[model samples]
Target chain A: MTLQSSPRAFDPSGTEEFAHWLDGVRAWAGTAAPDMSGWRSGAALDLLALPVARGEGGAGAGFLATCRAFETAGEGAVLSGNNVLGGFLFAMSAHLWACQEPLLAFGTDEQRAAYLPDMMAGKVCGAFGATEDGAGSDVMSMRTRAVRTDTEGWCLNGVKTFVTNAPTADLFLVLARTSEHDSYGSLSAFLVPRSSPGLSVGSATEIVGPAGARTAVVRLADVTVGEQACLGGEGAGFAVLMHAMRHERAFILAPAVGLMAGMLRRTVEHARRRSQFGRPIATYDAVRERLVDAALHLAAAQDVLRATAGSADLDELDQARAALTKLHVSREFNALSNRLADVYGGYAMMPDTGIPQLIHDALASRFYSGTDDMQTKIIAEGLGL
Target chain B: MTVDDGVLTVIREAVHKAAPAFDGDDETQLITQQVLDSLAVLKVASRLENQLGVPIRDAELLPRNFASISAMRAFLATKGC
Candidate 1:
């Protein structure tokens, strides 16, 4: 379904369309198994394929629609297993640039056509291969290298760590060093199809949050891709990633805000219903204050997130705002989750309480799409400090 | 007069404004470290852009631009400061 008018970016104070889209996503998610693991390969594919089906004008959804869907999914009991997370990450990474005017800012037209349709359709899932074992925040230090081939294509070499869904991904947006010119010109992003030779996903590693979501080391042992695989330009990977990351952070953080919203609601509901000292904990001054503080933070985060996401759509400021949004929301979200656990008290420590799970899930937000420190550094540099 | 003077003055003002939030001379010495750590530079960048009446381009937000008051002045010069 085509959008009525491009969904108008991501407005927290927007109309009922946001609520309606969220309700539909919740209904859809409700139909699935509570365990996100079951949806990993199949249902996850369908969700990723959504944008493709909706078409570039948008699937009658904008950043707000995507955010609402993420919120619905966040509230559900599903583990944010690799497949689930990877699908959304890939979809957002691709759509962030391709869907906008002057198509294919990062990837070439051929790359966009081949990947975007399938990526948007979810027929093929992609992983953002950025964080190497040696590099997390320092993009300039990435060792993953891509050297051009004489016949055609490029050879990729290096390993990526914390790759959310490499095991199941159909392709990867691999950021590798293409030139030794300088730190800025050193890195580039490539659309490396998994079917390419010499590309393999190593053993799945267990992470603290999002069980059943596979995190694995991706080993590129001279993986080769046609010239078409080059995204944007050879040395332009740094630019591409900078552009893509803005939207990626915005989209990812939107869901994160939703997660905070979900956690806050649960915390409040528990406080209101549960009792302590002969009255509901909600009646206690300290608990009430904490809850109120959490609410305010949630509101403020949403405001920042909406403003940052909107600014991205309107202007090209190298995605500094998105980084700012990520840093703020993720940091605040961690605090919010801690408050939630404090409200839950001992129950939060129990494995089955789900509060423990939520807390664990909250911790992962700090690492992905660049750490909070990294976000701060980007914001600092962006701010011209 | 070189634009460096104005840029340095703005940096000084931002540091001073953000100083109250920080404590001690040691911490104050590390203020540059903290402010430049993440996107905090955006706060400083906005301050300079507004104060200097110059649009800060993305490339101009690099360390060289903020490494020193002198560096910031040099960066602004490229923007027709």
Candidate 2:
């Protein structure tokens, strides 16, 4: 007997066009090579442009549609051997959520005209340079400096680590300290081209899951750009980052939901086929309970992500809800992955089963887009606690 | 934007609730004085949104708008709250 997993139902508009677009995404994922060249050849970067306005060289698919695209890509990645495509997909999504969205939301007319077209068309790739060795959740502590120069712009000097897509990106949205005072208002965001003098990208950092993500360290030594490169104005980096993170933290788990859904479907099929104690394991209450729990978890996570992404505004309340959503979804994804792994027992450790890769991806989700503790703090502040 | 006493009272209450540790006067600098951090400002914004029935836009969430109770009152007056 075949146990079939249903397609995702929260299409926002519930239109045939949207479903077709998702099917196309799934088809690409099924066949695309798990590398940068494959992404470009498949026109996958155009899919990341979904949230930009139509006039801005994008499909204008809105945030929920973009989340759905990520979800579909996630399921496709899992079904196509997550160990190879997981990290690569994550890097692309990070570009969408962290780099592209902020530029779309806050870029000046000139900046948008200069970059969005090629970025959306997949001709150019972008990366976010925010995290530093000394700074992670406490972003204000970053030591990257953007000193005002006598030339037409500012001189930047510092290093950013754990930057996704750093190795292959053509442009970087970097956050630097522009003020002497240690305040939120001290930082600023800049659009620095990778070809800038005194800029360098180190080798990719090997991570547990998402093997091809190409996370690397970026270094800037006396790199300079025109004043026009400053995004959202000087001293607005904190606000810019917060605005981008509100969207990211809310829907970052969409892919995880897809991954969990795919993993659960696979586990159920295995349970039905793999017999133990002279009967199919699917007949056992313990195995069925694990499957049921994973389904419940996936359902709750999907609902939370949908509710948070459904909103068009990024107000204070929405910011709080985004944090709560990230917190709950990441934790649930991790727990559900472990429970699903139990059904596989020793085979769960095998790389070919893809369970280990999913488990590792689940573990990594907790740390990205701010950790669980940071989310709790944001939620608490939202409650005025 | 001259604010009425009622509006000032509501703003002050929201500010106090957001930063209970702050015991300064209405003219004191909330952000510069570090009485309200970024998260506390968000809390104050949320409270003001509920109390005043006006949605605060992202542009108005700047530190200048929430520097003090007097500042918040002026900002709210502009919002027609």
Assess each prediction's global lDDT (C-alpha) against the native. 0.60, 0.79
Worst 10 residues of 1 chain A by lDDT: A94-103
Model 2, residue A289: distance off in Å is: 1.0
Where does model 2 exceed 4 Å of error? A1-12, A41-45, A313-317, B21-27, B57-60
Q: What C-alpha lDDT, on a 0 to 100 scale, does residue A341 get in candidate 1?
A: 80
State the lDDT of candidate 2 residue by residue for A279-310, as single tens digits.
99999999999999999988888887876767
Tell me the tens digit of each residue's lDDT in model 1 across A20-65: 5455455444444423343443234234433222444235344444
Highest TM-score model number: 2
C-alpha DockQ of every model = 0.06, 0.37
Clashes of each: 18, 1
Task: Return the TM-scores of chain A for each candidate in numbered order.
Answer: 0.83, 0.93
Best by DockQ: 2
